[model samples]
Target chain A: MYRSKPWRIFQLSGFGSPEEEGERIRFLLEHGETGFIMEHDRNTGDHLYNVDHPEVMARREDVGLTGATIQSVRDYETVLKGIPIESTYGHPGGGVVQHGPYALACYWTVARRRGIDLGKLPGTGQSDFFLTYLGCVTKQQVPTQTGLRFNADIIEFCAEHMPHWVPVSIAGYNGADTGLNAYQELGAVFANAVEYLDEIQRRGNISIVDAAKGVGGVSFRVGMDLFEDVAKLRAGRKMWAELLAKRYNINDDKAQRLRIHSLTAGSMMMYPQPLNNLVRGTIMALAGVLGGTQSLGVSGYDEALSIPSEHAHQMSLRIQQILQNETNLCAVADPMGGSYFIETLTAQVEEKAWEFFDEIEAHGGFLNTLDSGWLHQVAHKNQFEEQASIDDGSKIIVGLNAFADDVTPFDIDGFKSSSSEWKHALERLNRVKSERSAKLAAEKMRDLEAACRTDTNIMPAMMEAMDAEVTMGEIGDVFRNVFGDWQTPISV
Target chain B: MSALGKKILLAKTGLDGHWRGVSLVEKRLQEAGFLVVMIGMATPDEIVSAAVEQDVDLVGLNVGGHIEVVHKTVDQLNERMVGVPVFAGGAIAPWAKKELEDRHIEVYPPGSSLEDIVDAAFRLCRINVKASTLKIEAQINPKYSADGAKP
Candidate 1:
């Protein structure tokens, strides 16, 4: 157990404007957050669209509600203005697989402009297939094979240049929160990791050990199932170590060490009696801490109602502060390691997870299940059963189902984005377009499109494209023309 | 007891595509016998056009972003498809909920019961049902009650 290492207090923060998102990040840092994550506006970031895209234009008011409207490297500069990228750990807002290269490139480009060395910058990028294809299915995205290429490219690029960066964190949090049960989440996550490792091996640019180190820093979701979730995390580490050692045959201890980041499940945060979620967040965070997570992000109390308000965000930070400072949680790793029940449960979870992994492999691996909707069906069935259990009173959610009456005067209305966010974002987009060299941008865009069509690693061209001020939509257009949209198996 | 051919058009107002809430609602609505047309993540103009073209009795908006977008869609529907009611459910903030309620659009935030949503659909669509005909026969008769009591 890595008891000597301190768990990073990572929190997801963004919304309204780049300036506002920067302010919020600064606020969280001031309130004892060890790491910060920049969340991009879903309308633009997740879909790789700009503010002027027809789909975004129709919902202009939604431009900055979910996150900051960052369309180019210029917006990344504003969002990261005073943050110490070299010393501080950061996640630069690329949870969606298709947008990972663009987001990482923009963040790296801004750092390069500021004279920061890529090798010294410590951070992670989320190019999660679970998020891209299964969790939040976009209407248009590059196919899974293209996504795999992008991720493999990122892994190789990071191994060569950005030594301190965790490239493409496979987030099982998205899958679990979507509906996969504990063991299913574990199995699917490892299966997803195998996809990355197998791709890296086929590419043969980076060593398998180094690639495992890059892909080992995965994320999981911790819900109200306290002991079970703790066991899941424990099982996750053991399984990762076993998979690398047994399957790959060459395991450096550092490469085999599975670094976990646990986020409190947002779906577990109930809407009514929002304040009650504070306790829920605490308990879930405790599970993460007890399970020996390397990093953690607690869902806000108002998660079910709206995006986190500033106060709600502060409360999340406060909960972690109390857990870290007062509870003596950091003094030991794997505190429940010796408990008979915990040990049994951890072994049981690992066994079930391997079974699920075998099932996914039988169905032609994880990516195949995603393409054929087999994984989606598994998640959908779990969701239906969970909903039925809650409806029938078998699962007693305290504030929601059991104790439904609330008389507290908390007055929590949740955060609402400013109305001027769209107008401001539009102005910034126009300014960037007008100030940059149009011919140079067009040439770089063409080069990027050409790179996408070949076996070439797209990162270098992507970095060049970012420096040339190519917007997200342009890169997206290149991908759409070359790779085309994925055929989503499930109907929304 | 039959929905009497009542139809409801459903669409997400924003591009955000977490479909769990919307999918569950669609399943419940279909189980209740209303013909559901799910055109996911549609634009305001497209939603209005579909409602009018489909001649739906009600519109269901699965909102996951700023309420202003949903308000715009509702305005378009009211202007083009007159006499059609709209209801919405998602992670709506209280202020947005109030804004939608003021427009006479029922807003169901998270934790809203599916039964209540199904009931609201029936009422809003003006489906008149006598008490005798309201009962839905069980698809499978169980030998034991849910609590293990013999039936």
Candidate 2:
């Protein structure tokens, strides 16, 4: 333990029952994981719907397939009860903008109960627009404007309370995976962050400087493009610093220095020789590490399947650990700062990114692109074109289109699915209905709706609603009343 | 074939909107001579209603979330109508794929060939799957100032 100079190798893991999911998290940490990510079931979490909601009730069995079913803070406490959250950096999966506040508040609320002050807690939450607007466009979400407000609120909340927390990380990684090439990823992230910073300044509560620093920690997707991805990462840091100086005119060291976390692109993993994805993972992880990232989450070999199996999750962690320990990658910082190709690519990414950023601003900014379905089309155009290229063999995916054979000895199927996860969710849903106070839940929801309508920050009301046992369905009703559903342009 | 203009109800079972696989197929199915009713994203109820109201002969499910979610949609489809062939795609992990197949549902992952899907559409639509492959693919200009929204 003399040299704790290791970057925490993090992996997203959690599916099935809360106990089963918690066991997997504990197992990863026991092996070598320095950090953990708690993934909530998407069907319930992303839509902010309870199991009884007509849509959720239709397919109640799909409830916990993606991740554990956690309806209340009590459910969160069950999943994280034994984990040393204070010691280990914890990413409570709040990947959706609408869902993130509830997820983070629940995690922080759990920590508070364990006597952990909010200030000492260290972790980042992802409310990635790339995921919501581009890659995995949810069935329903607040309009882009409401989403910006939510992210801005979180940034300010963390600024005021939890200095160690990175609030609402902008995950360009989601966009890149969805098919925005390297430069587009760079540009979109800056454009997205501008939305956040501008919103914060408009609120006039927090300093633009502190909000910039708080939201500056972003995440990117680094895949097989070694030099290009690495340059993107390095360029991201300098671009962020430059953005701060240009916009807020604050040269505060922390505000300028951008911190980054990277996840290997899930789309990069090929289904044809599943074992080859291990090599793909290594290559992508190398791209991230070489790109000067502060943290990394490599895609598992069987990523195209369900959530990572235990072995797959472990191997993902081990891939990063090997890179950290055996490769001597961490011995220096920004090691690829001045290669001719890298420098040129970095500049190219920055220049092109600024162009896209200008485009987003011209379109009336990030929210406008989202609201008008402009950004969705941009991502759609990229996605279909990328697929067409792959189909026609114009863009080669090794082992997929080109080297379609496998002589490897090992066998790997994607993670096995379970129908039981859904059963557990229904049981929990029934338990919550009978256990909670009906009157208190109603009052809290009313308060939340009022708070959402007024200029007041909704997190405090959300925390209270959650504490009073308000179900996600009730909260969703409030959202529908206040923000209404976004009319999406794409038929996704 | 007697079913010359049989309707094919195509809908996304999950809110996760990935249009490439669904949209391309919708266009191809329509071009290959099927009535492709593209209901963007719907819960099971909406899908069933559209399927019945349109009197569609076959259902295509674009699944983007947990497979369990899509299964409920399929179950509703079966419950609402009889003998309607169902096919699905998108993020259907091996296990989910297997389950869908077990229900005699045709499953396509993302990388499945467009020809194969068009061929399946022909089988379901009861038409000679025409040889005309869908040639429309999006092209990106280097100087696109803003994104263009389209249906």
User: Whose TM-score is greatest here?
Assistant: 1
lDDT of 1 by residue, A1-492 (tens): 444666889999999899999999999998899999999888888888988898988888888988899988999999898898889999998999999999999999998999999989899999999998889998788899999999999999999999899998999999998899999999999999999999999889989999999999899999999999999999999999999999897579999899899999998899889999999999999999999899999999999988899998999999988987787778876899999999999999999999999999988899988887778777876776777677658889888778888899758888877867888888998999999999999999999988988999999999999999999988889999999889887654
Query: Candidate 2's residue-wise lDDT over A1-492, tens digit each?
Result: 103465568888888778877888899999999889888777778888876677776666666777887777778888897898898899999898888888887888888889998999989888878778767677888877788888887888889999999988899988787667888888888999988888889899899888988888888998888888888898888888898888789899978988888999887787667777899999988888877778889888877655688888888988988887887777777787778888998899888888998988888887777666677567656776677677778988887779887787865656765666666676786788789998998898889888888878888888788877676666777887899887665554
**lDDT tens digits, residues B1-114, model 2?**
222577888888765445556866775566555677888777788988999898888889888666766777777878888888889977677766878899899998867766
Window of ten residues with lowest summed lDDT in model 1 chain A: A1-10
Give lDDT: candidate 1, residue A202: 89
DockQ values, each candidate: 0.34, 0.42
TM-score of 2: 0.92
| Global Cα lDDT for candidate 2 | 0.79
TM-score (chain B only), all candidates: 0.84, 0.81
Return the lDDT, model 2, position A460: 82
The superposed Cα distance between candidate 1 and the true structure at residue A127, in angstroms, equals 0.6
| Model 1 DockQ (Cα-based) | 0.34
